[model samples]
Target: MGWALAGRARSTDEQVLELLEPYAGNRHRICRLIRLAGARAARFGPRLAPQEHRFH
Candidate 1:
């Protein structure tokens, strides 16, 4: 089966940041999660959209 790793995440900013750090180039597992988080936050909360747009 294909790996749908979108839902796998810890419950902390630092932890999420740490995971995404290695994918700073926007091409890795952690990076994808970061993108998903941003979209979700923006869809549910406008304030966080600006922060998420910075990466993409």
Candidate 2:
């Protein structure tokens, strides 16, 4: 799968997020989103709710 992604020029992060999108509104998503948002927030300043940054 890793090789396939490299061959296709696909981002692993995008693949992971795509898999997670179907479970949106679930706690799993909440946690993932929180983590992502936290990292971005650290750089940009100010925290945002997970919903503010959808997986699209």
Candidate 3:
């Protein structure tokens, strides 16, 4: 799920937020996925842009 959430190239912010809505209930499963999803988002997110600064 998190992979899908992060990997859908054509997906919009609205779509991603909508997909995440069900997981916001704070159940253990949902919470764990939320964290994992966040990490995935960061990995695949705009921080990878060429003009962006990179930290060691």
Candidate 4:
């Protein structure tokens, strides 16, 4: 899932949302992953700017 998310983060226009879409019903998991990804991105830097829709 990590590799897929990393690839999708760089490969797709949607960034992380495409990977998280299947878990839309699980808000906690979605937020957890987003935080985790943000932390990782903070350490390594983001490949792209995340979309604003995520915080909505």
Candidate 5:
């Protein structure tokens, strides 16, 4: 699931919604997962500088 989300990191929300439309019953839950994954990625994806690690 992580790898799949990572691969679609650049995809727009609309695109994701379209892709997930088939799973109508779980679409909301899936969207929530995507949001959580995005938040996690933003929190730990990369550092702007080598020294930035000390802040975390």
Candidate 6:
């Protein structure tokens, strides 16, 4: 999955907001959700990789 994005260009903040706008209520709420998701990933993502490798 990471490889899929390796060659892709990153979207700007505005583009991200636009893309998520339909599913999300508004810009502020979307930004908050993004922030919370980022924080959760930062905290737990590292631990997940090793566990995933073990399962595979």
> Pick by TM-score: which candidate is best?
5
Q: What is the lDDT of residue 12 in candidate 5?
A: 71
Per-residue accuracy of model 2 over 1-56 as CA lDDT, tens digit each: 22222333334766655655656668475556657654322134588666755566
Q: Write the per-residue lDDT of candidate 1 for residues 1-56, one digit (tens) a residue.
A: 01222354334655555555656776465555646665442124346434454555
TM-score of each: 0.30, 0.28, 0.33, 0.32, 0.40, 0.33
Question: Could you tell me which 10 consecutive residues in candidate 3 have the lowest summed lDDT?
Answer: 39-48
Q: Which regions of candidate 1 fall more than 4 Å away from where they truly are?
A: 1-9, 27-56
Residue-level lDDT tens digits of model 6 in 1-56: 11121222455666655566665657567556656665322122334343354544
Candidate 3 TM-score, C-alpha based: 0.33
lDDT of 1 at 2: 14
Off by over 4 Å in 2: 1-11, 27-56
Cα miss at 51, model 1 (Å)?
46
What stretches of model 5 exceed 4 Å from their correct place? 1-6, 33-56
Which candidate model has the greater TM-score, 2 or 6? 6
Candidate RMSDs in Å, in order, are: 14.1, 16.3, 8.9, 14.8, 6.9, 9.9
Cα deviation at 17, candidate 5, in Å, is: 1.2
Pick by lDDT: 1 or 3, better one: 3
**What overall lDDT, based on C-alpha atoms, would model 2 receive against the true structure?**
0.49
What lDDT score belongs to each candidate, Candidate 1 first?
A: 0.47, 0.49, 0.59, 0.57, 0.62, 0.46
Better of 1 and 5 by lDDT: 5
Error of 4 at 36 (Å): 6.2
Q: Write the per-residue lDDT of candidate 3 for residues 1-56, one digit (tens) a residue.
A: 43455666466667756777877775467647657766443244355446656776
RMSD of 2: 16.3
